[model samples]
Target: MQNVVIIGAGQGGLQAAMSLRQEGFEGAITLIGAEKGLPYQRPPLSKAYLKTGDADALSLRPASFFEKKQITLVDGTHVEAIDRAARRVMAGDRSFDYDHLILATGTRNLRPPIPGAEQALDLRTLDDALRLRNALDRPMRCAVIGGGFIGLEFAAVARALGHEVTLAEAAPRLMARAVSPETSERFLALHRDMGSDIHLGDPVCAVRADGITLKSGTEIQADLVLMAAGVVPNSELAASAGLAVDNGVVVDTRMLTEDPAISALGDCAVFPDPVTGRAVRLESVQAATDHARLIAKRLVKQVDDPYGAVPWFWSDQADCKLQIAGLAAEGDDTILRPDGAVFRFAGDRLSAVETVNDAKTHMQTRKRLAQGPVARAALEAAEFDMAQV
Candidate 1:
């Protein structure tokens, strides 16, 4: 292929462009994004950026890097439609044809349906972070809707900055969907100790101008409201173009769509898990960057190997850092180690390992998972030593 057109300019999209060049693909690459300015990391928007307000540090690549790589960056532009028959994408009056089309559209924050939800601020982009930082300059009461990573991260930072933080989650525990019950409880204690009022099993029914109303008929007064419930994949463009989309753009093990000429990656693509053969969509820098690298190899070097990188994730809250190795499904059995490492198991096999401020165990678990599924018996024989497993 002599030309490649990728939609979305988030971390995954930028990585695809860079990976293609690294793989020696001398094709014409065009990376399109709806956001303005150079692509930056989203993880830090709620962590370091909130504390330092350093936008420059979040940039994935400098302007000179793109110019040197000869990658065309079309920022502040939206792909209105894809012409499948003609193999071109239309954005207003501009049009670009591609020999291979990549859908890296990423995702957007899901705004829960509630009265006055529009009044709540968002932290999905750099612009959103800047607005939030400006609001935090003076004394303000902060109410965060959702106890997921984004919400909890922001609450930790807001509380650290001397703001009264009230975090509300519909689920019974913080990060309920991602972490084990034991891990969630650990964070609950940590956040509560930090003076953050934790409200679980009570979701915000409505976001008012002054604060939020909970499902349990409780009203919390605050000067600022943050919406970080979750994210929805940006798959509408792929679906409209007649490509199969389920949860995210459905792709094979090779990360290619039904149409071999097209491929999808990152948070927007759902592919078969190399281990379990289940369709899974992941939202992590590791998954996105790995997907890009694998796709680049396929396009440039004709590599046919399936994408099988073990998924890992991390979250920074206050002074504690939570790191997870491998993917775990809901209802996985959990075992808590004396040293505070939590291991998740699906039947007799190890699914994921959760650690707090234990980088040594986290890295070892990641390497182990990459080899293959770890049997529960093996872990038991090792006495829960991640290195032995």
Candidate 2:
């Protein structure tokens, strides 16, 4: 391939460019991003960036790194359409030809159809974090929508900054989609202990100028409202180009789309789980960077190996850090350990492991799961200590 053009200069897109060079693919690499300036990390936008308000600290790489690597970065450019027939992408009047196209378009915040939803601020980008930091400058009443990682992380920081935080969740438990009920309850107590008003099973009916109203007719008066209601994949460009898109751009185990010339990665690509063979989409930095590296190897080194990297994720709330070693289905049976590590089982087979402030156990669980499915009886014999097994 002489030229590889990547869309969306976010974490995954930037990684594809870097990985291409690392794999010795000396092609014309162009990283196109809708946002201006350097590509920064999004995970910290909800964590340290809230407290420190340091924009420079969130940068993934310096401008010098891009220049030294001979990577072309086109910032503040929105991709209008993809011409599959021409093998080129049009950004307004400009068109760039590509030997291979990588769609790392990522995702955007999902704004619900609530009244005055636009009034609520977002925390998906550095610009949003900067706005949230400015809003948290004063001791304002902060009403947060959603009890997921972003909402809880923001609540912890807001409370630490001496702001009254009221977090509302439609689900019965916090992080219901990601974590087990036991782990969700644990975080609920942690947030409550930190002086946050945690409301479960209460969906925000409407977002007003001042605050939000719950479905149970309870209104939260606040000077600032944050929309942490999750995100939607950016797959419209790929869809317009006649690519199959379910929740995201549908890619195979090799991260290649139906068209051999195109591939998708990061939050915008939905591929089958290597363990389950079920369609799954991951939004972690690990998944994105790993997909980028694998794609780079296939393009540069002609490796035919499928993407089977073990999925893992982490969230920082207050002083507690919740980590998951593998991807657990929504209704997996969770077995709790004495030391507070939660093991999820799917039909007598280990699916995932959840731990709080336990890095050793987390790593061990990931290592074990990677070897293949562990029987429930074997785990019980080891007293649920993955390190021992």
Candidate 3:
């Protein structure tokens, strides 16, 4: 390929450009981003960024790295549309022609249609975090919508900073979609012990300037409201280009779209699960970087291997650092070990392992899962000892 054009200059998009060069591809590379400034890490936006307010530490690569790598970095430019027939992308008056197109368009925060929802702040981007951090300069009552990672992490930080926090979740448990009931209950207690009011199974019906009203008609007084319900994939660009889109842009095991010249990855692409063959979309940094490397190798070295990297994720809330080694379904069977490791089983096969403040177990679980599925019978024989298994 003479020219590779990647849309969305987030982690995946930037990694694609870097990986292309690392794989010895001597081609023109263009990385387009909607946000101004160098592409920064998003995971820290909810954690350390809120406390330290260090925007410089979040940069994935320095400005000199981009220039030295001979990669064209286009910031503050929103791609208007893709002319698939012409194999060119239009961004205002400028156009970029690509021998191969990589769509790394990530997701945006999902704002519920509640009245005054737009008034609430977000923690998705660096600018959003900066706004929230500035607001925390003075002690203020905070009402956080959503009990997921972002909301909980923010609540922990706010409460530690001596602000009154009230967190509301639509689900009955914290991080219900991602964690086991045991793990959810543990975090529930963790947040409550940190002095934040936790509301379960009660979503915010309306967001106001002063506070938020729960579905149960309970109004919590607050000076600040944060919307962290969830996120929606940025697949409109690919959908307009006539590509199949489900929850995200549909890609194969190779992360290739229907058109041979186009491919999608990261939160924007829904590819089949390496283990289950089920369509899944992940929004973690690991998935984005791994997918980018796989795509780069395929383009430069003609490596046709399918994407099978083991999925892993982490979240920092207060003194707890929760880590998950693999993807687990809601219906997966859970086995909580005495050491606080939660093992999830899909049928008889091991699906995932959840650990809090246990990096050793987390890494071991990822290595074991990457090797292949471990049988429940074997775990039972080993008395739930991950090392023995």
Candidate 4:
């Protein structure tokens, strides 16, 4: 276990390199990523980056940090295939041997088969965000193709810039896959109040130079179209090598894949849900960084504790900062608080908590969820403060 090679230069990949150093791994480490430059945070690409075009702030660490940490970074490289028998990864003509391989390949934006969808712009990478920011320099009519966090965040920023914004969601609600209905309703109200024309249950049939046409025959006139529909995991690399891949590269509770020398993490890895036995793939800084830490500990110090870190996420739109702690399964019942906090429960077990601009409650929820499930009666009686327990 001297050499560790990580494919992908995203947050999770970089975190694995850093965590290995922190865990006292003096072995050879190589982090290969297709993206150029250092690993940066993607959350702000839709939020703050859209508003100010601040690229430097998104960097996880300075360039000097990587050199000082002795983490070999190979940027602008694509890992075409994995030679499982040879125990080496082939990036073009170059071959890198590894004692252990980590697939932090992450995910890519899902482009649906809609007419003229090819004309829609993407905001997944730094260059994409820069292109969008330059396009938004003037007064332009903007139509976002999704109602998810990224789409809504861009719409909010575009609206703030005095642009005419029309957000289209194929689903019945905004952020349909992530937050609770109550939280979604709140965010929907906030976006609408900010003068963005939000259309729900309306799928974009086509994108024209003028605007987007919905499935209901309604046409939205806009100068620019943003595609933030969703993303699919980049698990083809592992699947090609005969590894199990569900929604993502399937891993065990310890973050190890079918092969002992191989592991997966972040939005690319489908691991067991800490709360349930169900397999889950989470695209968040929390899951990526936590999984990296767990993998590093297991490899460096042989710390074999099961991966059970509490999941959390945050979205910034307008003046509202929505934060979520824990993972709630579908069909989870949500208990709404008077202060706009939504607590999602799976039967008697507490699953997740959604808070708007409430950092105190968010932190408390994460802390409490780490201690495992709490009774419904105790939570209802203990009031809003989980710390009060």
Residue-pair clashes per prediction, in order, are: 0, 0, 0, 0
Off by over 4 Å in 1: none
Q: List the residue pairs that clash in candidate 3.
A: none
RMSD, every candidate, angstroms: 0.7, 0.8, 0.7, 1.0
TM-score of each: 0.99, 0.99, 0.99, 0.98
**Residue 146 in model 1: shift from native, Å?**
0.2
Tens-place lDDT digits, model 3, residues 169-248? 99999999899999999999999999999999998999987899999999999999999999999999999999999999
Q: Which digits, one per residue and each the tens of the lDDT, describe model 2 over residues 341-361? A: 899999898999999999999
Model 3 misses residue 177 by how many Å?
1.2
Clashing pairs in 4: none
Residues 1-389 of candidate 4 have per-residue lDDT tens digits of 88999999899999999999999999999999998898998989998888878798898998899889889899999998999888999998898999999999999999999989989999899999999999998999999999998999999999999999999999999998998999999999999999999999989999997889999999999999999999999999999999998899999999999999999999999999877878999989899999999999999999999999999999999999999999887679999989889989989888899999999999998888888787777888888567875
C-alpha-based local distance difference test score of model 1: 0.94
- Residue 263's lDDT within candidate 2 is 93
Candidate 2, superposed: residue stretches over 4 Å from native: none
State the weakest 10-residue window (summed lDDT) of model 4. Answer: 380-389
Model 4 Cα displacement at 294 (Å)? Answer: 0.3
